[model samples]
Target: MYRYNDFDEAFVRERVAQFSGQVARRIDGSLTEEEFRPLRLMNGLYLQLHAYMLRVAIPYGTLSSRQMDQLAHIAETYDRGYGHFTTRQNIQYNWPKLPDVPAILSDLADVQMHAIQTSGNTIRNVTADHFAGASADEVADPRPIAELIRQWSTDHPEFQFLPRKFKIAVSGAEADRAVVRAHDIGLVLRERAGTLGAEIIVGGGLGRTPMVGKTLKDFVPLQDLLPYLEATVSVWNLLGRRDNKYKARIKITVHEHGIEEIRARVEERFAQVKPAFGGIDMEMLSEIEAHFAPPAFVTKPVDAYTRAHEADPVFRAWADTNLAAHKAEGYAIVTVSLKKPGQTPGDASADQMRALAQIARDFAHDELRISHEQNVILPHVHKSDLPAIHAALKAADLATANIGLVSDIIACPGMDYCALATARSIPVAQGIATRFNELKLEHEIGPLKIKISGCINACGHHHVGHIGILGLDRAGVENYQITLGGDGTETTVIGERTGPGFAYDEIVPAIERLIAAYLELRTGPEETFLQTYRRLGMDPFKTALYPEKDAKAGKEKAHAA
Candidate 1:
């Protein structure tokens, strides 16, 4: 919601001009691909398997109606007619011409958006809770802090080329919707003694070495936040491994050097850095906070929503799945599902974008949010507008009553698009969603998260799913590995892998068997898969995954008995 000031506008314009020149040189063969790789990457351009992919950052995942219109325009004009929303709360264009990327950036600049730092080994987009300003449970909105960090880190000379890409996420609520623990720097907003501060976490990451971040500081006063973060990442930028790409993430560095040592070093560095800040960061934050003030609320009766829920079972089901509690009276946060059955997860067409923009403008206060789950959010919709919003979504094929159900899967553009991927992720996710839809058991399963990644690089965040599926090319065959009991919430943990990987064709049935086991093993439906898994541990799910082993054990037990 923060509009670009004149300086911000000039900065983006210069970046676009520079990148346009670089791209033109590359096209003319004056600069080879090898020479242009880093430059292109810094601008969020990647050469995928088939074409160039452009990732545009949605800072803090907040969007205005005008920005949404610009995005739709980009989808229709530049690349394909659709864009893929990523788990990082960004959007990607899989097919774009080399010459047109500059134009794309210009269009984004028109709406106060950009692709800078969306890629490269620099500080990426600073993400925050999608419901930051509206969540009923929030202590304070964290996007102002996220936006502050974004301003500080963009093209920061010291961190432009670190050991690896660094990510930061902020969680404003008690529920941890932003997966703060899985980030390089995770900040949890809290207040004590009438003073606002953050619980600072460091060295958490997924990819090859999965780690839940350790508490770097129990509380960093809001004034001292940027200084503390600078010291932390600066330490990692120096101490992190540059020799091995696989071990370059801060998580690996934290693993190699104990958290205590890292903490001591960071503290020493913070001591030096703290004085230089002199509270300017806090001054900036006060200004940023004003931009995120809650929209003006209009009192409205919920009679229409109650009537629709009572009269129409379909509307009731959708309302139940798609809505979240809002801080304001007579308001609800509506999640528009992108994971419709048999469709690629998170692919939104130009028409869908425009429709969502219209919904945000007419019903929700001209505001929209992109969620880390790859869904669209209308954060301040009146309860009375629920039926109309649902109807519009239904007409656009966006109304899928499956937000936290098994069918609401998070998947990456695996081998289908990413050259780094070893196997395809989209097909596997689609197969699982289609299978579960046919079984009609997803709603019964209740709040199951299935995340699929193409490789160990975890673009889909597979390590944090309740049921995680990792696709790999094993000896020339596509193999799928399953991990159970993973969570990406306030209680974050990396999932445990089941015994062996399954073939591409066998993965769907394997998931089905695991769900069936949970259905039978649970004490009641109220106990979700995660709770039952925690209660019963891995034996049940592991046995279900490997039926042959289960049968062999069963036969041996019978003989012994």
Candidate 2:
């Protein structure tokens, strides 16, 4: 909840004015589409299949209730009556007219939000653990560091045109809810021998080639992190491939150079830049931290929450799935499921957005968070407010009890909206969610992550899901490929592909079969899907996914015998 100072206000207003002129130039035929492309992208505008898409950065996924209302207003006034919360902890307005983007940005600037650095070959939105400040088990809130990076990277002259787009994520909690390992620079804040520091992981990314980052340093003192990070990116900015855009990411650079060489180069660079920082970065970080100071937590009786949990099975189910333990006693973190069955995974209607804003203002601490999993979070809700919050969510049709369950899928806007996508992701996600809901087996399945991407860009983070589905166009047909054993937590693992792709129609049943196999193969109900997959490995799931191949192998083995 870092409020913009006068500098930030002036900066954003100036950009809005600048972009308004650029937009006007394009409309008046002074700028062609090619001429406008980079300008628009610099401002977080994309030409999607149907129209321009504007991605607004929600820095570290934190939002004030007033800001949320502003977003709702933008969704209702400038574009469609909904916004798609993306895996990058940002929101995309997909059908905005080119002429309206500057106005939308102006509205965002008024609320201390913007689309700046949400796109283009510069640092994207700096993300952090969604539960950063409120999680029960974090060393400290990491959003201040995230904000520091955001400030440092926003139009930084040196990194403005890196080889390719860069990303960074920070995790404050023991659990890596931010998918830190999948980012270009992943920082896990930890206290080491009385000094707060970060375990810096570098080179992690997901796209056509996915990688779990390698640890570059065991610990970088909190004060030196800015310099260390600058060195790392600067090294890559020089060494990263420019001839091939696909190989330009830092992950590829690290892969080619080896972590040791990269580490050596980064250390050398850090030494030169370390002195130049001169405590300025630390001063800025200190100011940012003050802005993120914890909200005043109120303590009260929780009898209403207990009564609702004991009396209503519906509320109980929701509480079981949608709530997380809070750092403050008698408080719970409520995840409002945007992935309601049969709807687009992250699309929140304008009314639902306003509803969440109101609920945040009334029942919670007037704060909201957008998780990378495409859910909205009420981070500091007292237990006594549970029933009322649930009722409000229910009224807005935002009450779904599936958080980590199978129906709570993370899906990218595949060919449905993305121009780069070869196959559809939304319908497949819908089909799977609807199918599992119909079977009423989501709760029984227990703690499964199903991520779907329309293409190999891994926008849905399919590479890290417990069960990942990657949609591709094989020949002229839509083909769906499955990957199992993937995880995005602290112990991150890239999923392994399961043989040939299935047809579009065959994908849902394939997922169902895999779940069925898990239900039967599990040691007990206590063992979750991920635990079972880790213990038993991918053979059983692969057999379940491709029964015909498994049967053929079995037949050949029998004949040989």
Candidate 3:
């Protein structure tokens, strides 16, 4: 994790003091809701359905146990007893009092954390693969680059305000766990000519106009990355649509103007500004890299772990599903699933947060990571500690053992919480998870990703889901639009929309029908729902979804009559 220096500390403290004064002015009637709106938003505070929600940035989703403890303390003291982890790997407290926000920010600053750039139309938190440092397949740790970007973008005078929110994600591993393709800017670390570089993918996003990013540059050398990134954002900042909020995202800009034109503009900007970098950014990156050095690992035998796995089926199942490939021998990246049946997806209670912090301190080399799917990861847990860690997590209800399964859903706070939402998403997610669990079909369904967004903003990443569900409003009635064949992986693809939307009541059964169709049509058990849907088209699933409609016209007429 990147520690805050004196400058960083002073900057945050000053921001906190500024917000504190703003809060006082609002309370004392000097600032009206209209006047105070942007100020609050800039500080990562939002007035949601029932209360004020405070979103705190977990930069690149990396945190120390002490930082986790601070978050837990904030949750306990300032807001509700629990916090919601979002798809961007940030955490949101849905019930913070307006007056206490500055205090909350102060607590976060105490731990070298803040809510800056977690919201608003500025460069949002720069995310990366949760398993960046620990993943065995990684070419390099993406955190150093992520941190560099973070420093460059934080309160960046040039980019303080953009047409819309900007997001950047970096991935060093072969698997795109960071969902880079769905971001405004995506960087894939690669090696070329025996030197490290990045494949820059730009203008990808997942709002109403979802798009997989186009490759702007095949290989940008390490030295040129910051300049290139600055150029890219500068181009978008100057030329991106400002007339309409919906059209303002770089995704639409890229869609409207061809990638070649955008590339040309970025190149021109880069050529002009590249000289200003003067290699200082590289030295800063190297300093950041020094902070992220890997922790020492013990050469421990895993015979005990093998014996435990052989003895306990439940532990074995958990190990198989939740453990990811680790870079160190006998070490595993453990994903703690937040998706327990009937619970709000991506929510962790204060106690659960504290417990996870304890686990990180005791067993995970004091390193904790938050995955983009809204789960926590203990990035360097020894295999021998698996049994104990599993037991503790199971006690906290964090060990659901559903990593990529159907039950591991990503959902947004819909009508139940989000004022912008027209339809509910959380309940629908719970319904699907509960129905699947009741049917005992989750395991049989195999690896499947189902993402639900409350609205077209695509906060839950519905566009990249293998099965995407978007909640919508149709003449004041709740409805859902389904999209299939989407994937959030290295081979990223935005889901294609199926015809018309379904009624809210009919969505769960519709999803069940889709899964059942996949089961029936799949060539083998190894084929995932997305794979099957890609091989075969929507027609097969459409038939299953509307069996009565698929019948003859006469039969349909008879039934209707």
The sequence of per-residue lDDT tens digits that candidate 1 reaches over residues 1-561 is: 787889999999999999999999999999999999999999999999999999999999999989988999999999889999998899999999999999999999999999999899999999999998999999999999999999999999999999999999999899999999999999999998999999999888888888999998999888888999999999999999999999999988888998999999999999999999888888888888888888899997899999999999999999998899999999999999999999999999999999999999999999999999999999999999999999999989999999999889999999999999999899988998999999999878898999999999998999999999999989999999999999999999999998789999899999999999999999998999999999999997888889898899899999999
Model 2 lDDT per residue over 1-561, tens place = 798999999999999999999999999999999999999999999999999999999999999999999999999999879999999899999999988888899899889888998889999999999988999998989999999999999999999899999999999878899999999999999998899999999999999999999999989999899999999999999999999999999999999999999999999999999999999999999999899989899879999999999999999999999999999999999999999999999999999999999999998879999999999999999999999999999999999999999989999999999999989999999999999999999988889999999998999999999999999999989999999989999899999998899999999999999999999999999999989999998888888888888789999999999
Worst 10 residues of 2 by lDDT: 541-550
Which runs in model 2 stand beyond 4 Å of their true positions?
Answer: 553-561
**Can you give the lDDT of residue 171 in candidate 3?**
95
Alpha-carbon runs more than 4 Å astray in model 3: 552-561
TM-score on alpha carbons, each prediction: 0.98, 0.99, 0.98
lDDT for 454 (candidate 3): 87
Which TM-score value belongs to model 2? 0.99
Query: RMSD in angstroms, candidate 1?
Result: 1.2
**Candidate 1, which segments miss by more than 4 Å at Cα?**
554-561
- Model 1 collision count: 0
The positional error of residue 253 in candidate 3, measured at the CA in angstroms, is 1.6
